[model samples]
Target: MTFLHTIGAIFIFAPFLAFIMFVLLSRKKLKRRSIGFSADLTTFLLFISVPVSVESLWGLEISFAVAVTAILIAIFLLVIEWKKSKEIEVLKYIRKTWRLYFLLLSVSYILIWATGLALTVISFA
Candidate 1:
């Protein structure tokens, strides 16, 4: 792969790394602040990367698939939280993190689109 492709790959998979870090730190209870940051960053990255990764891998046209996946996950979490008597916690979490989600989603969409445009221009030249 070229340097651009390498960079794109890193951008695409960065959230997965953040997720691993979050899980590991949370498990060991090593750093609460870092864990929170990682968790939030992971969610943001996943929201962005999932669609880009899907498009890149499958050449699909739909972008809302990631949103659907997120909704499904939220529903699943809601069910679990309901059973635990924390029914509103998921909504609260979404409210708190919605900005991060929106920012990442916008940024990731732009980055992926720019990369694709650049690649197209390069190919045509």
Candidate 2:
């Protein structure tokens, strides 16, 4: 269904899409630390998106419970990070590799978005 495809696309690309938005806005100040944070955040969100999207399509499922558990775990991790935010290590190669990371992340998400759109269009056709 079109709705299903749209939801799938969103779940797949939402985190990456948001990351690109943030990265573009922070281009000048995007340090190695920020890129590291973005990478971790992107992985975490994608992990969550899987079960959440499954739940959305199936009404209710065990995956929904699992997704909630994962969310709680993510929250716990975030809380820990917040307390020790100043202790996080800075990436040495950030200045040199930040552009590459940004480019890859952007390309990956764009591809994901395009795939979703294609799925939606195909489902309707």
Candidate 3:
């Protein structure tokens, strides 16, 4: 139980741990299986990590952040789609939104990680 919790926390905090694990296990087989699986897995983990990272960095509740992030992405995609074709291309927009969110969350995760490290150093100093 405790071990499982630790593993869960590690995955939540690292974001790409599971993705890396998969890639390592897949090795050459991963090429034949396709790179998309790794990307999709990282993206899914980012969905959880963004809010967790925010909360850890700020010591504030970010439970609603995930929902808000998803909603905002949807709205932004809708706007882009409207500009692109002025119609609901559900499949296209959804895929675009997921990719965009991955980039956005990846940036957030890096920033948060840096901030945390800086804060730790500052506290020591």
Candidate 4:
């Protein structure tokens, strides 16, 4: 059986780990950075929190919770950005910076998964 801590670690650590992996693999050609402490982070935090929130609120499984949370987060981010930003330059910046933002997010997710898997294996051993 999977432990809550394993899942939580993945939720928290995936982004940073992914960034480090990318940096190493890219041989310093690519630099890791974050857009800011804003909607993107909110989405990621919400995504990670979904499972726990759903289990607490509606008795949903982790996978289902994550799916719903992701959908909600995407909608929210899109709406907020569309409503708040009107300048073309800001939009352009967002487009250009999205790569790093997404890369960090992917890194974190992978780290979490790998940690969980390692924990599972170690527990079984």
Q: Give the best candidate by lDDT.
A: 3
lDDT of model number 4: 0.51
Cα deviation at 57, candidate 2, in Å, is 4.3
The 0-to-1 C-alpha lDDT of every candidate, in the order given, reads 0.63, 0.55, 0.79, 0.51
Q: For candidate 3, list the clashing residue pairs, or say none.
A: none
Tens-place lDDT per residue, model 2, 1-125, is: 99998865764647767456555666668665665556555654555554554455444455556556545654565566558674633353232234443444445445645766777799899
> Please, what are the lDDT tens digits per residue for candidate 4 over residues 22-89?
44555545334332333344345545543444454446577664566445655665666667776435
Clash pairs, model 4 backbone = 10-112, 14-107, 14-108, 14-109, 15-108, 18-107
Who is ahead in TM-score, 3 or 4? 3
Relative to the unseen true structure, what is the Cα RMSD of model 3? Answer: 2.4
Candidates in order, TM-scores: namely 0.45, 0.37, 0.80, 0.36
Cα-based RMSD of candidate 1: 9.9
- Which candidate, 2 or 3, has the higher lDDT? 3
lDDT of 1 by residue, 1-125 (tens): 59988865675666556567666867665566655556565666667575766577458855676677557765765676678785467557575445446455656665766777788799899
Q: In TM-score terms, which candidate is top?
A: 3
What ranges in model 4 sit over 4 Å off? 1-19, 32-60, 86-125
Higher-ranked by lDDT: 1 or 2: 1
Scanning candidate 1 in windows of ten residues, the lowest lDDT window is: 95-104
